[model samples]
Target: MLEKLQPNEIVDSIYQINLSHLKEKGIKAVIADLDNTLVPWRSTEIKDTLTAWVKDVKDAGLNLAIVSNNTSSRVHTLSEQLGVIAVSKAVKPRRRAFRNIASQFSLIPSEIAVVGDQLLTDVLGGNRTGMYTILVTPMSNHEFIGTKLIRQIERFFLKRIKNKST
Candidate 1:
């Protein structure tokens, strides 16, 4: 169970992940989380820096999709702004949404990388679907109530995993 919760890589932020590296790894698609992972939770706009990152990934010939648990309106608005496909209200750790994105892109799970800020949602869900999972630190401490609770549980397990690695 714990192994399933672990991500293939953990990065400080999405900015640190290089699209060139992902391309070198043969990753054809990227299924990313919206809130916290891409931007601060509830933020409606994408800044200039993030826009450049998105452009870089696309320029590298990688498909990008936003799979978020946020409301459809929120997700749709942001996705439209970013010009990427999206799956909103995606109950993560569930393969349905992940599968949908993979199918839509016509790519196998192995060719995709699932990037997000949560373990239980992004990491576990991505791992279950056989995709490479990348976890990033949350953009801010200000989050929704449910996320706050999940973070507490995630921290406990993450701590244990760190200790075991040592």
Candidate 2:
């Protein structure tokens, strides 16, 4: 159970992810968490850097999708603006959304990489489905109250994972 929460890789931000490395690993698609992973929570503003990164991913021949636990309107609106696939109200740590995206893309679990800012949701969900998982630091300190609470528990696990690494 604890191993399911472990991320395959940890990066400070999405920008740091290596596109070439993903391709080398046979990752043809990337499913990303919307809030905090791509942008700050509930923020409609899309940064220029993010826009460029999306283009870069596409240019690298990778499919991209945005999955969020937020409302449809919020997720659709942003995903449309970015021109990527979107799945709203995903309820992560559950495998449904991830599996759905994989099916939609006609890709197997190993062909997809899941990237997100939360351990409980992104890492666990991806790992459960046998997809590569990348954990990125939350973009801002501001987030949902429930998420803040989960962060406390996440910290304990992070410490354990780090200690084990040594």
Worst 10 residues of 2 by lDDT: 157-166
Give the clash count for each candidate.
0, 0
In Å, residue 86's CA in model 2 sits off its true spot by 0.7
**What lDDT is obtained when candidate 1 is compared to the true structure?**
0.92
In candidate 2, position 33 carries an lDDT of 97
Where does candidate 2 stray beyond 4 Å?
A: none
Question: Relative to the true structure, how large is the alpha-carbon lDDT of every model?
Answer: 0.92, 0.93
User: Using TM-score as the measure, which candidate wins?
Assistant: 2
Per-residue C-alpha lDDT of model 2 across residues 4-40, encoded as one tens digit per residue? 8889899999999999999999999999999899999
**TM per candidate:** 0.96, 0.98
Alpha carbon deviation, residue 149, candidate 2 (Å):
0.4
Q: For residues 95-160, write the lDDT of model 1, one tens digit per residue.
A: 999999999999999999999999999999999999999999999999999889999999998887
On lDDT, the leading prediction is: 2
C-alpha displacement of 108 in model 2, angstroms?
Answer: 0.3
- Kindly report which residue pairs in candidate 1 clash with one another: none
